[model samples]
Target: MAKKVSDIGGGRSQAVHRALKRAILDQALPPGSKLPEDSIGERLGVSRTLVREALVRLSQEGLVELRPNKGAVVSHPSLEEGRNLYLTRIALERLVVETLSGSLTQEQIDTLSTHIAAEEAARTEHAASIRLAGEFHTLLAQMTGNASLIRYVNELVARSSLILALYGRPHSSECAVSEHRELLDKLIAGKTDEAVALMTHHLDSITTRALLPRKDSLADALHAYAVAEGLA
Candidate 1:
């Protein structure tokens, strides 16, 4: 029988790691935010030791930086690092799509369509769109059926989304809805080469456009940037 994740100390470590990682990935703790170890430890109900270890794991993932005296700070990937992260994500996801092409079944396609539908609904409902778009990629990995690849893709997608949080443009929340559904349709229809090409194009669009300015709120914490861009 498989072990329940909540039954052991190791599981507690993983839970802390996951909780902290998600907070960082979602930018709930935004870039450059100092990780207050004691606060997190209190929240997670773990020792400072566990929280510190979790921070170290996050640092290894490039999501947090361990400063000599400043402790761990959520990473703010520079523009160059942002682009490189996106490029690497493109490469990895391209490979995943290529591998899944001509192999996915009708049921798999249907499942993905359902996930995409939820994403669209989330967009329509005005929920956090960037979070929804990231979920879309995560759903794709889940549907792809290769555990190892899914693990790597999850890491890449998470960190790539972090980069986007740092430097992505206004429409970053606006994922290509029609294109996503169409890619699944194409794959199910046995258009492997076309699916790969379309995957490449989709990633390119995200990477290229995120290089531009955003439609940030005038009242956003980044109001200075919004004003500088004449968006206010």
Candidate 2:
């Protein structure tokens, strides 16, 4: 048995929330998996109240569904929903590149470069690579400094991860890394049109891999994540 998570005395809810979110995003907690409050709390050594708080946050983020009598479960987005998400993401990311085109300071450019380097380093790690790929876009959104855009992009990127888990096939993180580098170059050159086009194409390629649609354990699954989060 995985040992119970400890060391989270007062911040247990946040820790639970992050661990659950990562599990869902990593597909360790697959779509439709039951998130029994007791099991999660017991596994993580948190209380039901903390578990509920985490679930409520995940629910609000569109990563978890709260069924009145059915408790909470990982969200299972339909094909149509997945398609819409990608379309919206494409549009939003276009805006991101467009907004960021000539505006990046040297320090910001270095930050992006460093992140892509990290992505390169994590190429062998499937879950980490995928999460980093999604986060790259959210990082861009944050740089845009548009509060509303940041919120929307963060939500969409997270849901997109869930969508990929449902419908995506085996992927190559190298390709995404290369594309990110090229996109970064375009942004550095202040080529608004070219940058937007590259951003659009990059996102479109990712969507194409998944938008087709096809296709869990609970405690045993959350155990690893609990340990990772130091909850176990």
Candidate 3:
């Protein structure tokens, strides 16, 4: 169970949605874990209607799978599906870099640096570090000021988290953090070609990492996620 919707003061359904979505992204709700409507509704102190709606939204984002009469479960992206996702992300992120390299405002740069700092701080925490790593890309897309691009990047990043949960090596975040720093340096220098190249390399490395075998059990994964979230 996660925090209650009443704690956040938004519409019950939206709050429940965010809580559940965060749980999924953090791997507290691991890939392929059952998400029973009654259990979730009870946990969040929301109605089954709200829980169902929240799950429907997550399914649309590729974060959850809705099976026939099976209710819902967190998505378990296959290696092939992960590859396709990485391919799409690489193309979209190339466009993001191309648009932002020579045009980023100091404010945007500062915000990005701040995000990197947060990533650095979370380095010892696996789930937090990985989620921030994905968010770094979403933040970049947001800087482009394109609503459609932002939406697509957000969805892809969410799915990417699931991919990593299913296949990434435990030490994957170390390389990702270093590459993010390098990519930021290139962007700040306005090296469009270099930035794009680094972005491609960064994404390729992620895809490679996601193809590795994951050895952690679901209980172990949830424990790590809970510790990272200060719930342990």
Candidate 4:
């Protein structure tokens, strides 16, 4: 029972993080927008204390930058940062697949298959598809039954999603859902090496295609956003 209450703040923290992160990811907040504590407090109907705590946690996770006198701003990850993040993901997730191999259960395989199906159904639901695509790694880690690995992979996936949100060229392409389908085929066939190799290649493609910020500014971004939202 004590554990339940103790879990509440963590749950609230995740809620706030998801809300703010999605706003940033969807370009609602944009990359350089500042997150004012009191305003978010009022918008989300939470306490400033909770908002502050959440922002600090995001800062620690490399999703937000807490500056002196500047408060917290959504992190504008450079191309270097994007490459580093994906590289870390490749290393960690490769290990996850290796560990999960030969140990994966029929039940886990069924669960993953269902997730892939949902991904297909969500293709037209851009936000749903994006979230499900990010979940592919998280789902795999959880199926491996390693709590620590799941936690690490979840965080990496979250940051990676943020990066895509900030810099991804307008859904001109989609997450290679077919690659996930093939990955499942390998796992079911116990072709662990194939799955690992495919994941490496997949992430490498993302790194290669990413665009650095160049000289974009926050004011320009805000103006564009306001125009899109009919505020300008």
Residues 135-219 of candidate 4 have per-residue lDDT tens digits of 8878998887788888888888877777776666554126557888888787777788998998898777776444344456988
Quality of model 1 by C-alpha lDDT: 0.74
lDDT of each: 0.74, 0.85, 0.85, 0.76
Instruction: Give the worst 10-residue stretch by lDDT in candidate 2.
Output: 208-217
Worst 10 residues of 1 by lDDT: 1-10
The parts of candidate 3 lying over 4 Å away from their true place are 1-11, 213-232
Best by TM-score: 3
Q: Report the error of model 4 at residue 43, Å.
A: 1.7
Tens digit of per-residue lDDT, candidate 1, span 118-198: 767765432245556667777777777789778777766767778777677665555667778888888778687898788
TM-score of every candidate: 0.77, 0.81, 0.84, 0.77
lDDT of 3 by residue, 31-91 (tens): 8899999898887877788888889989989999999987798988887788889999999
**Better lDDT candidate (2, 3):** 3
Candidate 4 lDDT score relative to the true structure = 0.76
Off by over 4 Å in 4: 1-10, 124-128, 172-175, 209-232
Positional deviation of residue 82's Cα in model 2 after best superposition, in angstroms: 1.3
Per-residue lDDT of 1-232 in model 2, one digit per residue for the tens?
Answer: 3455654565766788989999998889989999999899888877788899999988888999999998999999876787788889998889899999988999999999999999999888777788888888999999999999999999998988887767765664558899999999999999999999888888887756434533325776476579989999
